[model samples]
Target: MSRDITAVFRPDPSSPNNNTFTNITPNSGYCQPIPANCNESGRRFSSFRLPIIFRSTAAIQAGHVDPRQGAMYQVPASWRAVQVANARTGETATLEIRWAGMGSQYNLYTSAVELVGGGVTPHVAHQRLWGGSEWINAPAPCRDGRLGHFNNTIYTFFWHTSAEGTCAKRASYQIPDLYFPFLDFGYELRTPDPLMMSSGQYTGSLTYTVGPGQDVDMGDVLLPNDSAITLHFNLDVDHTLKVDVPPGGNRVELAPQEGWQAWLNSGQKPTRLFRDQRFHISASSRFKMALECQAISGDTCAIFDAGTGHAVSVDVSVSLPNGITDPAGQPVSRRRLLRDGSGTELFQAGSFVDRGMGTLHFEVGRERLAEMLDNGGNRYTGNVTVIWDSEV
Candidate 1:
């Protein structure tokens, strides 16, 4: 049987408003999310109860699960990698998952029900292994078979170290063909950056062999019903890309710096004419920019003089917020916009930038200024369309 793991990432209105995935899968009815571990480690975890069971035809000596103590484990406690692909876009990303912790509604059956309540205390069993420090831990009955009724649980926490990890216990008495009916497991996932990933569902699976010297080793004493168990992963990302402008922001008026008072009074020649129109943007994905001008020039847009039949090219550029950057990871500042969409094809955000201020620059050089000034009564006007596309 294969377990299902689901995670989703979206812009949250909570503290540390990061673009990190949230584990939507509930615990296998065993382990829960611990605030200290999750906060310190920057990783998301979820739980699942696998249908695989460990049945013992023969008795297991006390120390097989752990070389040192009498420990029992259900997971391999090692890293495994899988490649997830978006079904629609054919885009692929690598996902790494490992057994972070484990537990179960174990059926650690006793030979008789009369011996179910007076075994080792939970603290005594807890002290046998290297645990009691993770999400959940329930010690199995050790001394008395009656102990199984109190806390017939076998929980363990895993570590990323090379030494590997196992929980502890030891039986001073016999458990009579000890059988564990199901496996409850916790998994930690490492995924690619959601900002760079396209919005969609990505799917993949990984199966592990569960037996002696296998991925989910239970030693020679225990045998699992399913030789291999698969875990199916589903990663969903919901992103946001929005642009907003103010009431008077639509109509742009480009004029020489300090206005035309000097040119009108003393006939002073103006060096250049420009205007900076501000806008707000909130983004959580990578985007590209392009332009569609009503009056097209060689490299930029042009404003046409209706009366004099004169047209002047106005240079257009953009300045994005601090977090958003170019393909080369440099802050965008007055980067020229073109009809070809070059250089602005891959703007990425470092985080979820909410309502960040950006600017669109419109300018005419001194060379182009002479033509417009020559016609004193002429007014140049043209429509410039700026396109922000997330298709890239």
Candidate 2:
């Protein structure tokens, strides 16, 4: 089966703070570095202006197989190739496939993988197969760089453009040896750990094991025309998924108060089936919360207090969704934790404070406050004022 994949950004859908993923264009300072072309170009160029070319869908076929057996029939696997049409040259450049379909620990069906192109091996001269016999050298950073074939059916390749600065070529079909299969495979398996909190915070951790899938862990930025990778995820059972809140703090809660049932059942475990693949799986918890706050005073300090109101104390307590426990698994005493009381002024003032007079105080002993902090200190202190009138 064929599917479409898209890129995700850092400052995502929820908060509007940082938008590194938005307004991305050629030479926008955030584009990935130029790829190291190993063929005969003898130059370094960054292809940052390649558009994504994707096949509409993939076609999976099967031979005479018994339905009761529940086995996948062999299919003619091909690279569902996509291209990044260079805007400058109006030419459709060939993009290399990096991570093929996801991989599995099982050796079943050989994983349907392959890699076919020029200079796929190391120490070999670049053989331009696309435009002409332009000799390019092997990629400079050739540690993990090279043409890769998985299970011998899925073909994938990765290369860097050699230009002076970060820019795309004005010609289409610029990169030689650029042909990718239509699809690879996709499968996803997830295990959820519900982290219960005593302070009414909804939270959980999902342990995912993707088999027969590709691993895509390049630098912070993704290279242009980098082939997409995919995985199939089958959930064993659908359970109530929700994010925890910070005590009484106002945050979007994701709890199924009523009829919130999972799509999958308990007996039926989710299984990931691989196929013609080029996709990515990004799993993040929607049930997680982050705190943001500013430090009113220049005191970057973290002070601990036992439920006791003493100036300082030394005690450890592990808190859960329902209760708190000491190192010996016994119930520990409760207390408030305050970093710098000066920062709480703005929140408690319920309004704007002028530069000099208002002071902020944060308390943690209260049950609600402790519960909010338990949801992962999503709320952090921030500094809104650079130059204050008076010091705390």
Candidate 3:
């Protein structure tokens, strides 16, 4: 059987602390990753649920699938790798996941079954590894993690394991044929950084056999209704590329860096006319930037004087915040933005940048400034649009 599993990630402004994906996949029972249960495996492991149930090959009236005697399992606990490709870009990333904990519901054949340490009718307790002090409360069969919420038809138990080997737990009574109508599980995922991945759905599939001497092994007697299960994963990323321009910030006037003071005081000729337009940006995805200009000179945007018919090349460059980087993984510092979209194809984020300050430099160079100065008493004006697109 094939099942779908999904997770989503988007930049959160208020909670702009770390980068992580939230699992939106539905689960059976309370089979999520609990803090106490994941302490041993560190913070890298998570969990999910599977819709699967095991049935007995033959019905046993009153017996237990004892650990030392019969019950054996080899869960898909070790890391399994899969390649996920973006739905748009065709770029692939590796996604690794493993089963950390497995829980199930064992249905009761009859209501009068006896539990080892459970006195109540619907017994709920941790599975004992052996008969002595080797029970729950000590080092459990989950050698690397701990047990979480437990539930079955008659007896409720939880289990976790990190080591790559077979793990077994006996039934106080028969672990009912109708167990795991839905299996609660925990898993550790080694996913590619969302910052490095393109903005789209990255999809992949992982399938495991469910039988004796297989991935979800239930040993010799207890058989599963399904022979195999395919878990189809869809990890979607919704990127944020918001640019907030200050009020009246659209009109840019360029007239030398230190203003026209040098020319006004000593009759000195200014080298360049420039203005730094500041903007605040919040971005969490790969984006490309380009300029759309009303007037263009060569490959750069230009400002034109309608009366004098004089057009001067206005060079535009950008400087992003600390967390943003250019295509070469260097911090974006005065990177040139051309009309042809050359040096700004893919500006990536090293971290989530929320309302980070950036600069747009508009400059009339020495040559261009000289032409504008030569044609005196003329106002230069033109519209320039800077486009930041997230569909890169």
Candidate 4:
């Protein structure tokens, strides 16, 4: 019974220790056993921090990501310089996202991508997820009230991820050209009238926006900041002219032969012949009318002597209404006479503004008839001709 017994658990100095141990330290004043790395663990507990990173893909030649500002992105001029030549329908320009750290750890959280401010229209926007072998269509997200609108459109795409490791997502934004309706003179350019006049050179502009859906400080990614493009074109018009003579009052009736003979024998003056006429004209340019004479006998008015065969000359005069103008607005003379075979100008128009309906009063008179009767009472006849001319 003799010696006091002591119990202790200790590892042998040469033996390999495999058992686990815990420090059963008391909260108040009692001596406690500390672990080997206690100070290191305490320091780490006070200074622990997690990193978050968002970045553009290596394939992106022109755009950059700002990790400090909520991963905001921009494409400067150098990036914009990369041109898309005649981008086709269904063709797309990709904006990719590469993320690591805590930001990429959302197992069920949803993120959205959007486009705004560009002339592009009727385009398709969607997201793709990385499958083991290929990209697969991800479930598109419904519209979220938080995103609001962009470029007057609510175009948005939502995506979800379940993996917590590094993830890469992409938005394929279809680049489709925009078109506008154009009209001239109430007619489309496709079926324009051939006779329509030209409106000359024309210039116009179109505005557009293209960017992410969120209303952030970042500008449009695919277009200029101004978002306005100029349109230049010219309207071509053709020149045209139309001329017509109205009927029903266009004929002139000369005095009867007996009446003229009685007047010649009695020394009474012959009655002058008169006619009222109208001409309809439509033109886009200047125009005119020329007159000439064709003599069947010796002159426009000549009597052939049956016995001596001597020709007797008679004078004829033609007159039109004074103050009358042609479609071109030029004044037409009231009187003109046939001289030689070359025709003389009877009417003229100077401007397109002056073209339209016109009227003319014609009067024909004969002189030196008594001289024709004295040369042996022979009959004579001639013809008068008129021509209309225009710039086209």
Model 3 spans > 4 angstroms off = 30-51, 58-69, 105-153, 169-182, 258-268
Error of 3 at 45 (Å): 6.0
Q: Tens digit of lDDT per residue, candidate 4, span 47-129?
A: 00112112222222112342221222221111111111112222211111111001111111122122322332322222211
Name the better of 1 and 4 by TM-score: 1
Candidate 4, residue 8: CA error in Å? 99
Off by over 4 Å in 4: 1-242, 246-267, 271-285, 296-373, 376-378
Per-residue alpha-carbon lDDT of candidate 1 for residues 1-392, written as tens digits (9 for 90 to 100):
77777889887535224766776766653344443433215654555667777776675453344432233553555677899899998989887887765554333454223223345555344333223221133332211111122243442332222225443345544445656666656567777778888888999989888777677766566677888888788989888789998898989998889898998899999999899999999888899998999999986789988887789999999999988999889999999999899878889988888888999999999988987787653789999999998878
Reference-based TM-score, model 4 = 0.32
Worst 10 residues of 3 by lDDT: 129-138
lDDT value for model 1: 0.69
The lDDT per prediction is 0.69, 0.22, 0.71, 0.28
lDDT of 3 at 274: 90
The 10-residue segment with the lowest total lDDT in model 4:
179-188
Order the candidate numbers by lDDT, best to worst.
3, 1, 4, 2
Q: Top model by lDDT, which number?
A: 3
In the order shown, the candidates' Cα RMSDs to the true structure are 5.7, 26.4, 4.8, 34.5
Better of 1 and 4 by lDDT: 1
The sequence of per-residue lDDT tens digits that candidate 2 reaches over residues 1-392 is 21222222332224322212221112211113322332223422222222322221212112213221111111111222334332333433222222211111111122221112333432121221211211121222222223333332223333332211111111112221222222222211112221111111121121222111212221111121344323221111111222222343332222222222331344322121111111111111112111223322223322222342222111111112212122343432222112332322211111111111111222223343333334433433222221211111
TM-score of each: 0.78, 0.18, 0.80, 0.32
Error of 4 at 156 (Å): 12
